[model samples]
Target: MGLFDRKIPFKYLLMGIIFLIVIVLVLTGIWMSYVNSSDNLRENAYRLRTMTESYIENSFQLIDAGLKLYDTAYNHDMQEAFAVVMAEYNGTGGDPSRMDLEALKTAIGGMDVYVINESCVIEYSTVPADRGLDFAVIYPDFCIYLHEIRNTSGFYPDRVVRDWSTGTLTKYSYMPTSDHHYILELGLQSEYFEGERKQPSYSVIVDEARAFNPYLEEVLLFQKQKRLIGNKTYVPTPEDHAMLDYILWENRTSQEVRDTGQERTVFWEVIDLRDPDYAADMSIFAKLTYNDALLSQELARLGVLHAFAGLLLLFFGALVVIMVSRELSRPIEQLVNDVNSVASGDLDHAIRPVSGYEFSSLAESIQVMVDRLKEQIRKCEINEKRFMDLVQFLPQGVFEADAEGNITYANRAAFDLFGYTQEDLERGMNILEALAPEDHTRAKETFMAVLQGKKTEGSEYSGVKKDGSTFPIIIYNTARMVKDGTITGS
Candidate 1:
């Protein structure tokens, strides 16, 4: 008749369905949270890697351009100083042996110079070791300079040579006197390229790396790092040296991206400075590590928000289920109790209506049935009273028993005969109890026979009173059949 009229509670079923929905939502939230975090991390890693490489390239380019300017300026100044020394030599009778070469060398800033007589022989010299040697014998390739000075009587371009054994760069230049009597030779080392000029140091490069890229954590500069050869050896070959130079050049030009790490990434590249100016050429490795602190913080906040949302979903889902289940079941439960009240013969009891369309309709139907039953019961009571008045005045006692041998109605004369009060009969006193103990089984059989429509005549049996006194009595039973002809009682 009602949703929960049987033993199982419908609210538990509703709660179970809600629990499954909550579990699915929680799992989906967790999955989406991890995916969001991982995607953010990957994107941040890529962005920072590109930023770091660009900063390194820009910084190195600035330093390289500055050094080249210094180199070009120094070369022009040195050629002018050589021209001055040659003009002064032509005034000394075209003989450097008679000239003030020491004063001339000191006045020109203590540079190395030599004088070659017309015989192509080293004569007066600032460097004592080169004083008496034949120029053609020491430098067999001096024929070109000799031919130029002898025929054209002009100066020669500066030649740069790296003395690898001594780790010094020597610049050689030859100039003829005005009278064409001598050739002046000059040599300057790599230091003379800028004459104590300032250059960007490793520390400066490290600072520049950080200055340009704010996300940089630290810069690691490995100077003169040897090339890796096989597994156990670190011997640097020409090819290895050349490869490092190429890598450095490619990095500065193209800016290759490197491997990335979590939270922070380390990027490294070789910086080559193998040009002729250096006494000893070597490469440096610049390792830049970058950190995106803001991105990391954002991911942390995302995690917290994900957790909070999941918890809120669970709490609100449970509350809604509880409220909804109670709302749905409350009216049905009230209808069941009202129906039970009518079943217990409380025909006059009022049936209270409940909420909702279906529940309200069920309550209305129950009330209509109760009102019809009350009318029927009123008519039955009037007929029963008339019957009882005739039976009450008669000498024979009358009673009615149900199918289970429980007395439903006992007339006044029947109650007086059985020594049972009206209250005792109203308390559902069993009619079988009025019979003698030995007659109980026979009485039960007789009741069954009447319910099955097998017997109609009354029988004589020994009846017992409440005081334990026995007497002979005749009991009659007839099936109490409903509209469907089903026997409900006898």
Candidate 2:
């Protein structure tokens, strides 16, 4: 509310309000920019996470497809073996022993195979010790999964299972005879396809991360128990290990920032690449660092620019206010000086035309007043001269005095009657001096009474000339006033 106080000028108040508005708007823009920057960072973190997940998932799918192709190839080869065994049984009346299971197993890229009868008993196997044994007794779950796939369709779709005896995960492909009396099983360890032999290299992950996000400053890959598997860094720092430790302990997938003591801000994003097949845990982390001071560099420049602009505005605004105030007050100041001059008896000191309609009308009014004053003074002088002539030719003497009873004017007849020179009248002569000493009291009373607006008829008084001669004289007393009817003197 003080902004609107009248003691402060209107232009100054308006400039202050405008400056405050500019400051508010600039601050609001800065706040909104920060908010939007934070939001964009969060979104970028999530999108990077998604991209990494997709890359791993796609790699796993490709490996699984490769395993499925091998399974299909093995299934077809085993079906051919079952058909050969049946044909040999029909022609030679014996089990199909001529079919080399070892060579067939080697050709099918498998380590073992087992042939089982309708009762789920192994009749032939690459390892002879497994013959005459119940296959379901050895690995019932695996046999069940095999039959489930065989029952479903010609192509097998089954996942790997852990073989408790060998401490290894194993995958199997199977085929059955058309009569459904015999089945062939081909077994291979899961590691043969998904272990170090075929898994994606750590370099692939690092390369892909670098390619996807150029902002990445470094990447660290770790196995379970904090074992460092791989790392790639554009700019290595000593604090990286500490930051990674914090991220692992917190188990947070979100991005976190750290102060690197080098006038830079660094952020980290961790991804847990967990898989059931692997015996240990794995993680992927990415680090990105940037100069935090750079964030405010532009804003600092903008602030300086705003300050400069505000200074420019203030300077121009003050200049304009001064000019306008002077323009408005000029005419009034001129009129005041002219009035002072006229009061000092310089009637010719007249007003000139002032700029603007209002000031022009005021100047015209003042000129009219001055003209009327001059005219009245002219008439007063004329009346005084005519009265003086009449008094000079009269038979009696005439004189005038101020309210204080000091003689101000005397006509020629008054001087002649009193026998005083004109010099004596100019030297402040009073009529009381011309009266005889004994008649002074009565004459003084008469003069005072008349000056106070009382009329007096002629009174006989003894008068004395400057030569000390006394004579009998009659005096008439009266009062006079100037124009406008204000009493001046008698």
Candidate 3:
């Protein structure tokens, strides 16, 4: 009762079903590719996100251990100059009132110096105007950093940043004294900062992550100042600020997906920054954005390829079906037609040989049957000819007629007995015609009765001759039927 339940040719039905299957296969392949691509995108994004978080966390630890990755010799030289200056001004504790600031700068390789007390205020500096610069009021993030450094004896280096007041690109470093009395600050402004800024840094490392994953659109790391940096500088939007705030406030990971098929995620961790009171926490948050453009291209390409391949399958499948169906049924059709011809009484009709082992055998068997039948017919015909020759030599007359008493055959004795020439017999003759005018009615009745399956025996009657004469004759007539039910006389 389904839609395809109706009767149809086997060849066409098979072709239809196979073509439909090809179409379904093509579409399913395309759909599966999309699903797999989506899953791969999610997996790849997760790996990159996890790697970024681990790299930054480990990098910070290395940085804490005085791992100056950017420069080796230059960093050692800076440290050496800072040690000499520290010894020269050790007693002063960088007390601005006791030392001449101009002479201090010349002795320290022309580097700016800022000495801060426990209050994290710039109590003295080579630049006099920088005096009394309260870090807590001006730069709270930098102030937090200095407070952490005042408890450590290791020198800490920072990246090149433009000093807001002087608009000079400067590199800064800090060191606390043995007694934790003051935090030493060193600032250098040189052409080296410009080349170093353009060199390969951690920001480039984050951006290069995209090489490993095509779906990765960007990776952004937020500094203590809440500034986002990646390949190039990126200005933070309201959404960016809100997302960072939410992640930091929750102190956990967060993920979001955009309606435009962009997946955005932020990962955060709270690690002890090695500060006194164990009260301060350093927050490192990385934001990763995943895009679907490449996935879109791949899906489209897969669709087109599947479609083309399906079409090819259909086209070539149709050709194969046609050839196979013909090869299967053609020989049988020919055999059927030959059988029909023989059934219609054309015994001489030949059975044409066909291809295939089964068909050839069938044709040979049919041809053999026909030959045997023809041989039987020849023997029968020969026996009948001999019978007719024997009947001709007999002294008794014999003949054959239809149910209507029409003469179909006659022997020599019959022609002679009826006084009719062979021409008269061939033209037209009947039992009634052979009888006298007075016996005609009886002859007709006798012929009909004989045809009705009644037995007929020797009957006396007056037979009329073609010469207009009459004779007394005894007829032995019988009606018979043949295989096709055609009535005849004997």
Best prediction by lDDT: 3
| lDDT (C-alpha, whole model) for all candidates | 0.67, 0.62, 0.69
lDDT of 3 by residue, 176-205 (tens): 877788887777788776565555355655
Candidate 1 lands at a TM-score of: 0.52
lDDT of 1: 0.67
The order of the candidates by TM-score, greatest first, is 3, 1, 2
Q: Top model by TM-score, which number?
A: 3
lDDT of 1 by residue, 43-78 (tens): 765675566566665666666556555545556656
Lowest-lDDT window of 10 residues in candidate 1? 224-233
TM-score of 2: 0.45
The per-prediction CA RMSD against the true structure, in angstroms, equals 10.4, 11.8, 8.7
> Clashing residue pairs in candidate 1, if any?
none
- TM-score of every model versus the real structure: 0.52, 0.45, 0.54
lDDT of 2 by residue, 263-306 (tens): 45555645554444322233455454544444445446555665
